[model samples]
Target: MRIATGGIAQETNTFQREPTTLADFERPGFGVVARGEEILDLEGTGTVYGGVVAEAKALGVELVPTTYGGVMPGGRVARSAFDTLRDEILVALRAALPVDGVLLVLHGAMALEDHDDGEGLLLDAVRDLVGPDVPIVAPLDLHTNLSDAMMAGADAFVGYKEYPHVDMPRTGARALQILAATVRGQARPVMAHARLPLIAPNQSMVTTWQSPLKIAIDRAREIEREPGVLAATVLGGFPFADVPFAGVATIVVTDDDPPLARRLADELATICWDRRAEFAVRPVPVDDAIAEAMAAPPGSVYVLADIADSGASGTAGDGTVILAGLIAAGARSAAVAQIMDREAVAACIAAGVGSTVTLAIGGRHDNLHGPPVRVTGAVRSIHEGGFALAGPMGAGTRSSRGRTVVLEIGGPGGIEVQLTEVRGHPHDLNYFRAFGIEPTERRILVLKSAAHFRAAFEPIATKVIEVDAPGISSANLANFDYRALRRPIHPLDAGARWSPGA
Candidate 1:
């Protein structure tokens, strides 16, 4: 049996001003440029494609890779860019017709300039071409905005349980294995979905350990191992997408048993909605977080999570609120990865290493986060800006920060500020390690991330605090002017309540 597989993935943050283009996908970050059998090179490496190849090899099925290209989470994709990627996948799949099954690696929250339900549209087109007899299984990211069109088109779905998504390869293996079984007539997978009217912040959704989301996901896994159950998935959903389906979702698949699927899906759905309050947490105020960080004991690494300026959520990554507070409070032994200031980095490069350079750091993108501050510092190091993920999330992928530099500001174990040409978040500690900076050596490690950083920085950190700085991706959802999101949603609409709608 041959299973066609490939996907175009992007998390569209409508609140972000920048527009994700085809050129962005060709950049050194997240974009993997391989097509057809050339994609087989990813077999033994890290990624969903690697798992697909491994599973197919073991299952004795030919894994026909159509194409795979995904960019970092960013603004709404241009319609032209979306069609180019989607059409390429479609054309490849058409050429590899008469496949027994199909497996897709998709991020469910994507949106285009013209199509709000980007994945839904893609799935609908694929379903039309393949027909209903061909079972389709899609592995989705944990932060997905699952829609009705997705449930209608795909036969089964699986999503990452961990927020950092360390289980990506495992999730891909599971999807392909399930499809392999279904194709061999050993299993008949039937799926049921339940969409909760709750949308919560991503800060508390880490599934590596016990939390509200973990509790529910753990319970779902327990039920998934039952005799008739095939798989269970809970998506916390991406709220910044400003789509109608931007809320919590649950999907349960069973071996030819719709009732079992429905029952398990409802059970997990109730668990998520029951702990709605826990998911709607508020970030600690910036000033409060700063004071606490300043007063921390020596030899401690406090991970100050700057959620607002998180480049992972498509923010420009040049916000100055947290850095300004840290400097003003006379905090020492601090290191921050990155405030994306192209001009600042260029000036430092021209000034040469060890030269005292006076430049305005951060806040260069927009006024949402605060204006730039003049910082007089010596250039510590400069690198061309490329690193591999030694972290839990996307661990083996090669990533780029684009012409990065380290500048020493303030005095006494001075603040090391990493500046980048691109607006990429310091999700992994390797970003600092690439420049010979040790993160554990610093008293305060400031990361521009919401929760993804915890996977890497948590091990070395003495404490972790989320800051409510003003920006597009702030933990405080009220900060955004959301126009398309369905109202009466949790947190955004505090008094809102929900249950499975008939």
Candidate 2:
């Protein structure tokens, strides 16, 4: 069997002020824009492409690698960037025609500046090109924003069941298996999508623990084990996206059983809705979180999650709210994984290591996150912000945060800040270890991540506290002015209610 694979993946946050451009997608060490044979480089990585390549090799199928562009979650994609990516994928697919099936590796929450449904549009175009006979399948992120167009364009979609998304390769393999079965005439796949009027915070969507989202994911897994069930998944959805479809979704795929798929999808969706209130989160204030950490066992390490400024959730990783609090309290033995500030990094680089420099760091990206905090510190070290993931999530995948510099505020054993020239997701310990900072030795580690960091940092952390810092990606939905989001969403509006087929 011959199968073609590739697509664009990006999680969009409509609340962010900056627009994601082609440059962002093409940024080396950060963004990915692989084409043809270059896609084979992901064969052993823990990514969707890696899974697709592995599965195809195991199945003895001829896999055609096409264009695949992806970047970290950020502001709504620019129309020109989206068009370029979409066109590249289409062109590659056109060249790889006469294939048995197409496997798309997509982040289903992608929103463009001019269109709310970027994934849907791409899927629709692919479907149009493949006609109806050729099977089209995709593996989606757990934060997918299900849309009617997306549903209409694909034969089946397998969403990542885990929130930290350690199962990207697994989801890709599962989706590919379904497509292979269809191509071999072993199964007739039918899928159903159920959208719930709820947008839960990222902190509440962790699947590693016994959370509400975890319960729904467990139920989805159970349903997948039943007869005729091909795949099932519960998406917590990306609330930062202000699109109409920004809410939780349940997707079910069955072997020629549309009714069963719909029933199971609706059942899972209802389960999430019933536990909606449990998904709401109230992060502790920055000062209180720091105090709590200080009160802990003397040598134990604590991970203070700065969720609001999570680059993984599309905020510019430059919020200084927590930094301000730490500095104000003269917090010692604390290391901030990162604060994205090009100007600060440049100043530190020019100052040279060991030189004392006073500058304003962070809060230059967006007005919604926090203002810059001025501080005088010695330039500790400077290095290129690039590292390979050594964690469960996206392990083996290379990541970068551009130019980086370490600044020690208030002298030795004080708060050490890692300032970067580009935004970053410090989910892995390698992000810190690469800079000569040992996370285990730190008393408190401030990270600009929501939950993905838990995959690597949780086991080492004595305690994890989500800090209530000001940023666009925070649980505080009220901070964002939504103009296109559907009204009466749960948690947003306590009175919001829903029923199947409503």
> How displaced is residue 278 in candidate 2, in Å?
0.7
Q: Name the candidate that leads on TM-score.
A: 2
Candidate RMSDs in order: 1.5, 1.0
TM-scores of the candidates in the order shown: 0.97, 0.99
Compared with the true structure, what per-residue lDDT tens digits does model 2 show for residues 126-229? 98898999999999999889999999999999999887888888888888899999999999999988898898888888987888999989998899999999
Badly placed stretches (over 4 Å) of model 2 are none
Which ranges in model 1 have alpha carbons more than 4 Å from their true place?
A: none
RMSD (CA, Å), candidate 1 to true, equals 1.5
Superposed Cα deviation of residue 487, candidate 2 (Å): 1.4
How close to the true structure is residue 397 of candidate 1, measured as C-alpha lDDT? 78
Cα deviation of 163 in candidate 1 (Å)? 1.3
